[model samples]
Target chain A: MSEQKVDTRLWSSKARNLSPYVPGEQPQHANLCKLNTNENPFPPSPKVGEAIANVLEQQAYDLRLYPAPESDDLRASLAELYNLDINEVFVGNGSDEVLALVFASFFLKERPVLAPDISYSFYPVYAQTFGVELVQIALEDDFSIDPDAYRQPCSGIIIANPNAPTGLLLSLADIRKLASEHSNSVIVIDEAYIDFACIDETNSSTQVSAVSLINEFDNILVTQTFSKSRSLAGLRVGMAFGNASLIEALTRMKNSFNSYPLDKLAQAGATASVLDNDYFEQTRQQVIDLRKSLTTQLTTLGYQVLPSHANFVFARPKDGNASAVAAKLREQGIIVRHFDKPRIQEYLRITVGTQAQHERLIDALTAMQTYSEDSETISNMG
Target chain B: MSEQKVDTRLWSSKARNLSPYVPGEQPQHANLCKLNTNENPFPPSPKVGEAIANVLEQQAYDLRLYPAPESDDLRASLAELYNLDINEVFVGNGSDEVLALVFASFFLKERPVLAPDISYSFYPVYAQTFGVELVQIALEDDFSIDPDAYRQPCSGIIIANPNAPTGLLLSLADIRKLASEHSNSVIVIDEAYIDFACIDETNSSTQVSAVSLINEFDNILVTQTFSKSRSLAGLRVGMAFGNASLIEALTRMKNSFNSYPLDKLAQAGATASVLDNDYFEQTRQQVIDLRKSLTTQLTTLGYQVLPSHANFVFARPKDGNASAVAAKLREQGIIVRHFDKPRIQEYLRITVGTQAQHERLIDALTAMQTYSEDSETISNMG
Candidate 1:
């Protein structure tokens, strides 16, 4: 094939300028503790696998046919899980795709949509891709969303409950207030980490999650994913629950874009995972327990650890640089997220791995501290 | 929960005004001969089912972890199938989703993208959805794309080879010429029906698929799907092949949006389906044989059948309204697509079903002819 000149002009002007969102690392080493992305340490419910296997064993002819264009069975399953009608649910490839569609169909346009300055990085990309005006609401001093500040002439609102990086959550009351204040607009509460935040009272105190807040409003579209708590990150299943009309709009838009968004396997696996309520609860409690343990250890080590509701913890070392500490951990095959941005530059966001992985991290941190103190003293003496 | 007022302003003005593309009937009845949507009437390869089952049977931990940010293994399989390097492949949920991404990321801002006015109905909707300008080229009197018509300055070009609703393919030479002439632009040949077209050497004697044309140019991207010949329409897997740089741009765009576009099951199933060459060829040949038989039967019955190279044949009844014929067939449990729009209003697109299904359709048409004839005689007497 002959190399041809590229028509750069053919691409959207913004396309060339877009800074794509970087997901957490997916390392190739089999033994590495994959704490870079806050994935659940446990496996999905066993039924999920059986369900997927059963679907796969069906007549290959079924695969040749198109999936239910709107995924009615899956939607019905989600509706039953959330105590809502079928019209109240919309399923997509993942919560990312769901949010992208939500942005394309509803959240981008006339007025600048509002989101926290430090929030899901992809939110701004969606705004840019759709040519929607943007308004970034800076987080409060404590890295929490100031709901009152979002009371502007905005087109819509999006707030990640127990927001990422910061791992802090807004109360159900606060979320309801925000939704009420934006009564004339769509208020999307991205509860990706809600499973970790909303605790099961009978199980543990750390099991508080915001999913129960879904019953509080009509305008509120509560988005969730099986990525974190359900341990189906690779499976790419996410759902959105909202009022019938809003869900209808999303369905219409999805049909226009791609009739079958979720494939057969995803529908089968996700439905099974959701139906196995015990597995979901068990995995979630484990993550909650791990998260709490990590926070306590980080605090004991003289690091300022944020009170996280998600499966990850954000901490800034007291004596040494956070980025330097993160770099040291990486050199030892420990991968944690380190953002170079201003507000969170000094902090390291580490995923909550298993007990053994956390112990290694603590040991690594302790050794690094000793080395840093000795080096500093020698430098001062010289 | 208080109902919030929806702020219409939040949606992109273009999206707000978009008349989303409505897909053809996906009837709920399992007994219906579902030809309206052109889904293959066969099952996907059994190997596809096996591959998917294998993924599910893997230790549940694999599902718990995030998938490879990019589906590298699946892309590698696609690259090999297309005789391209791994870097030259882009995989998405379906070709429609991939096409939408292409329209938004590459073709939207360039001089209005060009497509045959009477081609795939989704083209214009995508153009509007991405805020791209569109310059529709009228099809020739015979309802085929004329290469000369796209000679004007255009940003990009999209053509559905063996185009939907008509099933007439453009020659490889014609596609290459367009790419050579528009050297600075990307030329997309959506070969969604290429497997069927290539199966018939007699009917498509002068035609060469655009996939072969990819060997001659860098700007050409050929998109294919497992939906048709591979019979994995329900799986929602499609791939795009082009120069490394162009594929890179798409990769960047996808990462900015959703990192894991293909779920675990889809990746496994699609790879297995594409690699099952025997199943692929058998299904394609079956559809081709059925098409030839159906065309001969329709022609004998006085219907004006298009020179179809795809799995579906486009025909207009000799003395009956296309819509009326379709409606009549539906009454007897057969469904076919009939467009009411201009240029193709009188046409009825019928998917090549199993031999038995085709025989049933012919039988229904023969029976309907008597009904029409008797009604015609009564009208004539009146």
Candidate 2:
């Protein structure tokens, strides 16, 4: 009873009145093939572990000392990885933190900020948290952004490259045009899935690199994460690459807020991940290969698979209900994500897993189709 | 020239608009005594490094999976350390994050929050960052909080117990009375240095011991960090203990903002630090002994030293120039914090380093005093 009696005055208006976002299922079941959360199936580089071990051996006591407040070493390595100067980097707890900082740092007050109507689910959350005015631009009928929509006078603009759930990308040309057109506005490209976006072989048309756009603009900020490709989602490391002035603004806010945002082991582990070029190439290529195979299989089953340049494929079942199909798959020890929102409600975004894991998802789908067919016949006969 | 152009529109009115809090200087120079920041010179427990090493070996691959949105293992260990249930705890990047969350989750949009004007310098920064109204209650003549002034109608009260910069403690009886009187308000006891506060053998008080008060009141939140006492400042870990509902609000905000704030290695290292009681006790005693020695030496050298209950001493040179004393000490490879603000302008807040480090500080101070005395005599002759 005492627990239920929470004093309302103790919490913020937003905290007392928040509808928190629910992340996809991460079940504790041992045998479940989890394809709900878009996580990479591979491990981080062996060198990442080696680097942490090295930090431990040298002076474990250094951890007692505060880490470099701004994570200078990791930022320097990220600059090398992204072909950027150290002045162009701003790292945070995760891409989420980076994005939140973007909203707090540059996207508030003056005019309403613009974002896709159906983009990363966290965009509106950030806007709400910061009390920023929002102008949601609708995606095209095929679930893609029309950059012209952002031409309107706004304080800033944000777009998720190879955006979530849709897995469709905005090309570097389009991003450059958007940035050039809105030269006075702050443009943020959340490239959480850009590693997967750059994985196409044979110079495939699917390759749409948004980071390249940064070279042509002063107002653009590109945010990236180690969660998917480096397979370090649990590590919570993310960085923003932008013009030096933009980075300076974020740095001021970050230091004024939480100085030692990056922990010691994170700085060491992430720096090593950037240095392991072989691991990055190997895992990226594997995910690309797996995505291609999965796309072919889904096409054969008569489903409409979107053109994905991210780690997951968004598709709708051709025969039965998508949610029903997702549930049936779960019954067979498999997990896939289904959004119950407007347009995305009919689709399921399944993360690409290992070969065996993909086979399990395929087998579950086939079984569900067979059961639906049998049920239809039984109902007609009855 | 383009790099010099800052984005005036992108930042929040409060961020680009307001002056930020400057933390203690972290000079780039080598061989400086480096005591301006309150970082422990001692290494963390040996077991902490071993635990991180184990995580690196076993779960480095699992970095692809998101860390538990909340680190349950660390929370559970913290609960065990504080003798509370798992539901009574909330953890974040550091005490800074926990405090920022407090401003966002509990102190926003209510009646203006109250605090000692000379308390943690970050309080007003957080208030402005969150768009909350603030009412600063000035510290007493001796730079200590008189909790009676905090009884005004307010949303919440935040105090750094065994207050920072001054190293003066408010007795638990006073803290308990304040909580009981303001049962309707959220009272946050930031116990960043309480382990050092109980330096005397007869005074074995703990910040964790304050958690027991949670059983009687639902509005009290006690936050402690691994940065200071556990000697894991580089790891960015801190935990808050309060009623379950208060914890839930912070959990919701943390989930909404950054899901995996605690990285893999941090979880392992912090958990080990929590469980290793012997190492914690040993270093805590050493700091206590050093503080006593430093106080005695400073008083003998004609400085008015406050009776410190924390890891640092707050002293004013009897020669009446704390800033000049700090500057002179720094020139001699010694660094101590000198806050050039209204009430504490004449005081120097010095972190108690190792025995040898303290000796070095004492020697620097003795030399500076001798120099100032000679200068005074020469001025008299002139």
Q: What i-RMS does every model get?
A: 3.2, 2.2
CA lDDT, candidate 2, residue A336: 89
- List each candidate's DockQ score: 0.51, 0.60
Tens digit of per-residue lDDT, candidate 2, span A1-382: 2536765556778896665566776677888898988899898899988998998999697887878887888989988877888988889998988888888888876788999988888888888877788899999999989888788998889999889889998877888888888888889989898888853454433546665666678889889998888898888899899888788888877766677788888888899999999879888889988998999898887679998988899998885378887888888888888888888888889999999999988877766666668885576578
**Residue lDDT tens for model 1, B68-95:** 7778888888778767788788899889
Query: In candidate 2, which residue ranges exceed 4 Å CA deviation?
Result: A1-9, A198-200, A204-207, A374-382, B1-9, B28-30, B203-209, B371-382
Stretches of candidate 1 exceeding 4 Å from the true structure: A1-10, A199-216, A370-382, B1-12, B199-207, B371-382
lDDT of model 1 at position A260:
82
Please give, for residues A1-382, the per-residue lDDT of candidate 1 as tens digits. 1225444444566567666777877888967766788888778888988887777666456777777777778888878876788877889988998988888777765677899999888898877766667799999999988889998987789888889889987887787788788877788889898778753434554523344555666577778898988889888988888876677667667766777888877888888888898878777788888888888898988999988878899898995387888888988989998888888999999988899999999999877776668886676678
Q: What is the lDDT of residue B195 in candidate 1?
A: 81
TM-score of 1: 0.92
Cα lDDT of candidate 2 equals 0.83
Chain B TM-score for the candidates in order: 0.93, 0.94
Local distance difference test, candidate 1: 0.80
Which CAPRI category fits model 2?
medium
